[model samples]
Target: MVSFTELNQQNDTITELSNVLCHLIDERSVCDLKVTCDLFFSYVDQVKEHLDLEERELYQSMLLHSDQNIRNTANKFLSGSGEIKRVFGQYLKRWSKNKELRINDHDQFVKDTREMFQLVFNRIEDEVEHLYPTVRAVQAAMPK
Candidate 1:
């Protein structure tokens, strides 16, 4: 069972990692630093795991909901997740290959990374603002 509390915490963790990674990039030449690299990969894994869990568990309630609006909401978020995954995958391939960071251009890496982080932040906000409320409603209407 993926509790809302746990899901929210996962969001918080990803948000924190994003913030930290963004700041870490600011220190210049931090990209090849082992600690920074590890943190970056950790952030990537955290996001993938969080999205997988949401699709596998959280969204099911919304999808099976009796209300058409709730089902529509689920579909919207599901589509958004697919887009995020696709974009995020491209980001990974662009920056890291064979689990290694290949920074041919540091400035471009920073720019793209910040954009990627914002993409994730936007998705998190949408989940919190739209999806979670719908899920709560679905759960509330269920007979415990």
Candidate 2:
């Protein structure tokens, strides 16, 4: 099982990377934009991997938890996370190609990127403020 500290560290890293990717989208040069797009794709990949890990290690356990409330909350989180994954997956398919975003449609690209950033930011805040603490309490109450 991964420690809470480690999970939180990973979350912090993802948030930082997200901020960088959002800022990178504003670069005006075509070459810089291409580079930024590559970085953005990489960040998306990282988020996918992180979600996979959380589902496997955290959500799965919570879903099977003896406590009914814990199980229900885990189910809710999983359902909500699926929507987030879908949004990111669609964004990746739209923006991950060789087409330069800056040259393609800069305003739409910025708008979409900002929307994703806000979604992810809210998701992270929920996890940190609510889900993580609840999960920790559940874990602490578990028999060792």
lDDT of 1 by residue, 1-144 (tens): 689999999999999999999989876788888888889999999999999998999777788877899999999989988998999899989899866788888899999999999999999999899988888888888898
- lDDT tens per residue, model 2, 51-90: 7777877887788888899898898878878999999878
Residue ranges of candidate 2 with Cα displaced over 4 Å: 30-34, 98-103
Q: List the residue pairs that clash in candidate 1.
A: none
Candidate 2, 74: how far from true, in Å? 0.2
CA RMSD of all predictions: 1.1, 2.3
lDDT of 1: 0.90
Q: What is the TM-score of each candidate against the true structure?
A: 0.95, 0.86
* CA displacement after TM-score superposition, residue 23 of candidate 1 (Å): 1.2
Backbone clash total for model 2 is 0
